[model samples]
Target: MAATEATKAADDAYDVIVLGAGPTGENLADRAHAAGLSAVIVESELVGGECSYWACIPSKALLRPVTARSEARRVPGLSDAADVALDSSAVLAHRDAFAAYWKDDGQVRWLDSVGIDLVRGQARLAGPRRVVVDGGRVLSARHAVAVCTGSRAVLPNIPGLAQARPWTSRDATSAKKVPGRLVVVGGGVVGVEMATAWRALGASVTLLVRGDGLLPRMEPFAGHLVAESLAEAGVFLRTGVEVREVRREAPGGPVTVVLDSPPGPGGPGGTPSDEIIADELLIATGRAPRTEDLGLETVGLTPGSWLDVDDSCRVKGVTGGWLYGVGDVNHRALLTHQGKYQARIAGAAIAARARGVPILESDRWGAHTATADTLAVPQVVFSDPEAASVGLTAAAAERTGHRIRVVDQDLAAVAGASLYADGYRGRARMVVDLDREVLLGATFVGPGVGELLHSATVAVAGEVPIERLWHAVPAFPTISEVWLRLLEAYRG
Candidate 1:
């Protein structure tokens, strides 16, 4: 809507207003509407946000086929349907289809169907309980206002990187053709994923990590296994390294990166040069919360440009309980699922308060919520053998003063794992809080383990006792049977 119309609409009081129409924002609106409260979601960009358009949905859609084909080749007995191939054109077509070609029509229809008002424009905090739309018109909320602004990929401040040109996760994931040689910076999930994806698509891939291993935040074994997996996939793992500088070199100009260390057997390992060149450079360092230009200072709500929220997702400095924040915008766990969880908790809490229900301060289901984020935040890497993990790491558990018992299992021993391939070498590790008799965290690294994560997620989130989890049966010949083996190993 235009600024005038937006202002006119904003002139009235809304019971709850959610800014950003990503999964978290949408979930917030849905839960609010379900509780019989009036809610509107304001979206400046695509309704489905980064996950739907670029980050998760499209990338996974592209990688799944390549993974399936690779699996079929590795496990010949399971597949009898002759030759398998991924049609590059069809893969791109499917990726576009998954994103609806960036169209918001389906999202709009869903919102209309669910009775949530849809506002299209930039939104910023206009007051303690109000938002300014498109930089002009203002909308005030009666109960709560939420910020679910998500995050943007961050490019590092490396010299000549911008002039030499580099692709962020956004650009690389949406490319039409794979480059001949792709150099990816940062050994986090995105870099590892793109490295494997493009390598499978005929690109020679080199992955650089500032740390000594891939996924440094995960357990050492998990990181080691993943780095090994990537290396086996023909990716050059340049860990514990730095890209000192970048410059365009040659006629067509490949970006030449000056490394901190030379490559040679005696001089430092691979090629004996202080520099390397590649057709494309991809920076997958990480992301920062999108909290700028939101007028956070208007209500004394600024905490170093990020809104400080309590357990209930309420903006800490906003008086009278008016302002709130959720999703990646809160600088909490940046996973999309975690964001949605916070939104639901916040929406429920706000809805109950509007009804004068005398809500509890930290009810498990309240708006000042996000209980799951603390214990059940899960992540899955979409690379060939896919890595999935939830909750705390072993070090994190120990740091928290928990008595921990760790059961780390190799995938090949599990009956279900052997069927995955003849030469399957994967890993699964669980950190159990012995004091609570519950799992504090879990990590699984292997093919087809993506779906297996939710079970562990529920176990950890629900605090399901390891003894009780034994009854959560798995069907025959399924990778899930690894759970039984895991429990057995834990028991032993």
Candidate 2:
């Protein structure tokens, strides 16, 4: 237990103290300092956090080679050069380079340049605005403390799983050598993207999905298209299956798994597969917030639970608004970009409060509010034929009681898409508010669709009316022309 504030004096004090030096925390401290507040950031691991070292950076670095080579093959003149199989060793080396070789020196220097103090130790809330680091050093916050600890990947429950030594997102992204045979469990972005990347890198990959399709949360067709592409690329794709047991007799040897009977309509429960051997096993089922040991309990907030926050990213239920929750810890939006957006808003709010300046805007998304997270959040799954979506889905819009008109466009039919790839295959959808005549959401699944997401995000967030959208002409012979096609379909 930390000494009471009356007993021990603070070793150091700052106007703003941030926990976790991930992108979210970094942004928060930067914003706070820019507001003329002294700031210090605490981090126990690499300063860049998951997105920089594991989840987003290395994963995308691993996928980009596969995507570029795949696109090269689609072009007529480049097919011969791209026909050759990818060299796994080279790909792994490239991923290592992009992940900064798992070092945080560069990031630390960045913090120094930005004038934010860096403290290397695990931080925990003692009480109110006091924090204890490494169970000894004390830091005091004059105004606010932001928790940007982020989240970690979760492993599912299964018999003998502990002894089996499975890989998580970190292992999958930072793997030194490609396994000869890799088995992936789960069907979400991490599962599918890693499966695609490893399979392209010469691993005999098998994807086991408990659900009937992949990318279950998106439009049904997104899963169908990615599944088809995975199957065509030699990944043994299976759905409606669950892992029963995992067994690895010798450490560092091959892994063997047992599968339960298919849970489809035809097979309720009957048999179990005895042996499915693989070089490695990755469980990418889900993620849980990293608030488990942040001393949230000291502040009357439950440990190992997501922190509830208002639009300004300030924790609710606390007597005062001195505690803020940013990034994955808040559970507002899990995407790193969304977390960074929230940090900027929370930082400004903290600064205004410190100066006794009233926060004027509450819901208008002014300098102090994070309205975009709820209104125009964007995400991109860097799997083959990237799946990018912004704002609400068609189902979400309907559920929210918004009367909407749905627009669909076959991306392959778009002239620009046809010119981009010989056998271009993809789809685009937009959900428009019937009364407002503005976009509520948009989804695109195809090669190079990720580049088109910003426009959709701008349209959805800006709430540009349909009439104004018609005049925003798309450039000729570009995949962006699908915007015009979508507009035409909506009008008809």
Candidate 3:
């Protein structure tokens, strides 16, 4: 049902219209269609969106081989074989394959197979329940219109940064040739992941952090362990430093990055430090929601601002509940998986409302509510020592006025962890709501801990009591046994 030239010229309508055909948008369309709604989705670029080509898939493809090699090196008998350099050409080719060679044909086919219409153009709200494509093609929605346009990487306003053509998350993940020297600005997920990827690919990476350490939002020790692993991997980390200026003589020339260093205790004001010259520079500072040019002004909504939404993903301040915002545009959880979760909830809500079904239970874990976004949003960072967390950290729980107890466990004490790799080092923490006797949050830092995050997510989201969690025994001789150890620590 792609919009051919004939279909593009004619006025089109559907029961539900979705803007931005990313994973979020795709799921929304699919769910709506499943619920007996005629759905159409519009996109300005590839249908699979950012995660399919730039952010997640390609990035993970680049990291898997590096992680495998690192794991092999950690084993007692495989160190020598794993010491060989990575095949850059093969790695880049594999990444391209995972990115689907920058093609959207498969996605378009999926949409067609699902009986959803696809319009190949940028779309925006022309009025309530009305959407206008780039060439003035009008689309009217009978039930709802969902906005899933995601975010883009934000480059800092440093002088000459734009002109220098620095790489954003997209460029770094899709880069074919690894630079000799790479300067990574920021210590967030993108910064750390890209720094790790390029460093493993034989680049001399210098990571500059404006804050005290990496992953400032997670538990303190998660950042500490990640910083230790990055340092051990030979990445030169410079904390408490900000980029003041960027200069590049030509398009393909070397980049010069100037740094501003704040003075220490009992010292004077900030001073400019040594300039860093690099073959390329990457700005992984942050991301801004892509709501700037969506014709929000026509609907009396401010452009360039994140759309506020209710528990059902319905945009606030919009009349009639016809307009909905999901994914990054709504400023909920920004992870792709969370966005998909929101999409499912939003799509189900739209379907239920269309059928005049009463949605009574919209609270935590309800069928039509996005409750997990607040209490149990899980995230995994694919660094050398992977960092995974869900719900409130201990500090976050305390700040929210919760009477909580914290339990910490040394992962090295677990026999399964010791068997996984030689000299394994890791830690796990569980934050419990003391009054409720339920899990509030959990954080795990170490190799192969990403898979264990779901257990914590279920505990927090399900509000499972600690006494009951003890009965949910873990199998022995597996890293999952850390859960049992954590329970014992909490009891002691």
Candidate 4:
């Protein structure tokens, strides 16, 4: 859908103007409309945003088939049938279908149905409650203007890297053809997940990690288990290695990656330090908040810096509280789901403030408070032997000075898990706050553990006590029975 000019006059104003039409921006607009506010959302790209076209949806679509076949191979009778290789073309087609072929017609209709005006253009903060779209249109906001521009993938400054045209998370997820030899740099979520997807799609994957292991933010055991699984799946893992340079002669040519010496203790002395040529190189280093060119300087804020927000998602500085930031721009948990949660809270707060609600109650778990951003953030990486976690890890809890009891359980010991797979290998950990007597965090690593994470998320967010969790029993002959075993281990 092309950017259509609004029929309203040039001086027309809305109660709220949300920048960026990503999921966070869309949710903010919807919530503000629900609160009876005349809202408008400005977007420079597709209405459904990154998760819709590039990151989450397409990547997961590619992964689901691989995961299903792996699960089938683990079962007794299905093993023989599942041994057949995946059809890469079919998988890519399915992924394109899930991404809607990068079209936003459905999302545009959604915005129109909800009565929110969609302005398609790059938007910049002009002044207090003012936004200027790139096409020389000035949008005036009567109540608030939200920044939900989200983030972009950042590649390390390796020599010739930019010229090499290395694939970012976007290209990796949306590639039309899988490369024969894929060298994936960085061992983060995108790196591991993409490597898993492409490798399963018949790419010979070599994963390079600068750190000692993958998933450094997760529990140590989580990375250990995932690394083991990747190795078993024939992904070559190279730890403590850095890509020092990159060179590609032409657009469709192979890429040559140069490596630096491995650092830190126990580094391999004989490891080669140069020249890894591959059909494609994926640089999934990290992401930077998309705040560089929003013209924040027009409002006495720094450009290219993350916007700090209170629980209400209001930008910390710039008096009068007319400016707000949510999602990746605010740097409060960069996951898509968490951004939507913040958008809901921010929208409610915006509505209350617009109505002259004298006191905004932003207490813990309040309607206008984003308590979960700090307390309980749930994430699931859909790799083989999936890693699903919520809240803090045991290390994070201990570092924060919380006296906690850690419980460990082998998922293989669960009767349902053994029956589910011929040789199920996984682990579960629960961190209990001694003083609060509630779950501080939980980590589950294994096949089919992604769905089980919501139970932990609910327990942590609700602050459910240990005693109360006893009555919430898991059904027999299901992988969820691991919860009962975990609780038993904690009790013992």
Candidate 5:
């Protein structure tokens, strides 16, 4: 433990101290500074965080070269000239360029330009409104403290797996060399993407899905289509199988896995197990918040492996009311964009409290405010025949006590979607709140659907009426024209 002049001298001085300079934390600091509050950002890792270094940037970079070449090949006229093969060396180099090789000088310069103090070290809650950096330097806050540390992949309790060692999303995304044979132990978005990416790059890929289908959280039809797409891309999908054991074969040889099918409804549990062999084993199971070693208990807040926050993104327990949690750490919709939205709100609230202004929950330009989260949070999977979703599902809306109406359209039936790809087969589902005639949620699964998510997000977030949405026309001969077909179907 370490003491500072502020600990012995000043009681309260800092307006806001944002922890973890990820997209969310950076947004929080930016909003705090914009609110004219003294703010400092503490980050132990890369300033741009996982999204820049490993998750989004590098993964997307790995896909870009192939995606571009594939599109060119799809067009017969350009197919003759399109011989663009992925140069693994060049792709890795470009990804490194995008992430600045994990350097923070560019981000640091930007933060300094915005008048936000940048501190380097791990940070934890010392008290209600205080942060202890490196377990010593105490920075007392007058207003609020935001935690945006984000989440990491959860390791499963498979026997001998930990000892065997495995690759997570980080390792898979930033992989320098593509394995000759890759076995993915999850059928989630990340797993599917990695499988397809490496498969296209000439790696034999196998996917083991504990669930019955791909993207279990999405529409059942979407799962079917995505699974079909994966199969077409040469991904071997094994469903309803449990990984019994994982063991290293030789010093540098392929890893071997023992898998067993669960007891089915019609059978006794006496089935023999199967074996899978791969050069690399990647675990893309899921993610949990990084709440450990953060002194959550000291703040009177009960964090259950993940920090739980309210709709307004405030930590539950605290005596003097100084604790705030945002982003993946808060465990509310772990998307980076949603986290940033909450961070902006938390930052504004902190600045307002410091200035003696009433902290409002949803304002256009207040410190403590959120619009993009509770209303509509969008997510896009950057895989071939991309998947995108926003807002509440039909079931979720009904659970929330809203009578919902669903409108679904197939890509083959929509004019723009027909031209999107020569043989593009995809689906779009829309959940509407019948009482309000507003969109509860929208999901699109097809080629180039990621870009189409923002329009749905705006409609859901802005609460744009279905009638007004009709006036917002999509361009001709574009995939987005499906929006018109959706609106018409909804009206019908």
Candidate 6:
């Protein structure tokens, strides 16, 4: 639709006004529509958000081939596959197809089919329930205004860095041709996964981290194992180093990086010189909420900051309780799935409030509250050796003063693991609450472990007793048999 036509259409009032059309906003609108409420989602960018085009979908498409080859190489019968390199062009093409060639027509059609309105422009709060888009279009909400703008990558301030045309997470996942020499900065999921993907595509990838470990958020052993696999896959793994300056003399040429630490054996990045040159540089340091410029000040909230919300995702301290902060903007759980979950709770709560229905805020498992965001958030890092974790780590549980006992299991010892691959290597750790005999947390580090995460998520979220879990028998031979080993280890 043209800008004028869109503005004219949005002039009318809606029951739910969603700012940002990511998965969170989309789900929120869907839920509102299901409750017979009119919804309009305003977006400044593509309708499907970052997960559709960049972070989750495209990154996984690029990574799936790398993992498939790695999985093939581990099987003894596929010796020829072990020597074969990935077809980088085909991999890139697959990523493009998954990302829908960066188009939002399908998403727009879906919204239309569901009777949800989409406004294409920047949206900001005018006051209570009023929103103003970029082209001076005014929109009013009767019940709620949900901010689901999600987040953006943070780039650290370094000399000549911004001018150097560095790649952020978006560029890393969507690059046309892989750079011959790629340097990834940050130890988080983005850094490691992209490092794994580009290196497998034949780039001489160098991963730099100021911290000592690759995955600082996960268990220590998870980092150790992934770092080992990355190094073995020919990624120059450098830890305890910082980039002081970046120099790119000519445009689209090699970029030189100078580290703060003194050069060691073969220099800082395993090169002869103290400086590391790369065709492209990626900064995956962190993410910041997109609420910075959404005109929060008009609604008595600080601009450029996280939106604080309650269990039901309603913005706290807002006078009318018509404001909601869903997804990354609220900083509850930054994962996409978690954000969508918040949207559901917030949507139902908003609808109930609109109907003057009582909200069961105190009930932890009520329909209008998002309790799992606090306790059982699950995460999966799609590296060569995948790492999946739900709930707390042992250290986190201990720090939180939970009476916990840690049970460890070797996944290779499971009969299914041997059948899956030759000499499969993996580990599983479950934090058991001694007082309740329920799982507090679970972490799995190995190949093909992502599939096992939801079971752990359910166990932690439901707080199912260990004895009850034991009754949930496993099939004869599968990686899932590791659950039996973990139980036996805990019992012994």
How far does residue 429 in candidate 5 sit from its true spot (Å)?
1.7
Provide the lowest-lDDT 10-residue window in model 3: 263-272
Q: Residue-wise lDDT of candidate 3 within 1-492, one digit each (tens)? A: 543221644448789999999999999999999999998888999989999999999999999888888888889889899999999889999999999999988888888877888887888889889888885789999999999999999988899999999999999999989999999998989999999999999999999999889999899999999999999999999898878899999899999998877655211233446688999999999898999988888888999899999988999998898889999998889999999999999999999999999886535678899989988989999999889999999999999999999999999889999898888889999999999999999999989999999999999999999999999989889888999999998999
Q: Each prediction's TM-score against the native?
A: 0.92, 0.95, 0.97, 0.97, 0.91, 0.96
lDDT of each: 0.81, 0.89, 0.91, 0.90, 0.78, 0.91
TM-score of 4: 0.97
Alpha-carbon shift of residue 130 in model 4 (angstroms): 0.8
Residue 426 shift from truth in candidate 6, angstroms: 0.7
> Model 4: runs farther than 4 Å from truth?
1-7, 263-272, 358-362
- Model 2, TM vs. native: 0.95
lDDT of 4 by residue, 132-225 (tens): 8884888899999999999999988889999998899999999999899999998889998999999999999999999889998889999999
How far off is residue 55 in model 5, in Å?
0.9
Local lDDT at 272 for model 2 = 46
After superposing all C-alphas onto the true structure, candidate 6 shows an RMSD in angstroms of: 2.1
Q: By summed lDDT, which 10 consecutive residues of candidate 5 come out lowest?
A: 1-10
Minimum summed lDDT over a 10-residue window in model 4 is located at: 1-10
lDDT of 2 by residue, 388-482 (tens): 99998998899999999889989999889888888999999999999999999999999989999999999998999999999999999899999
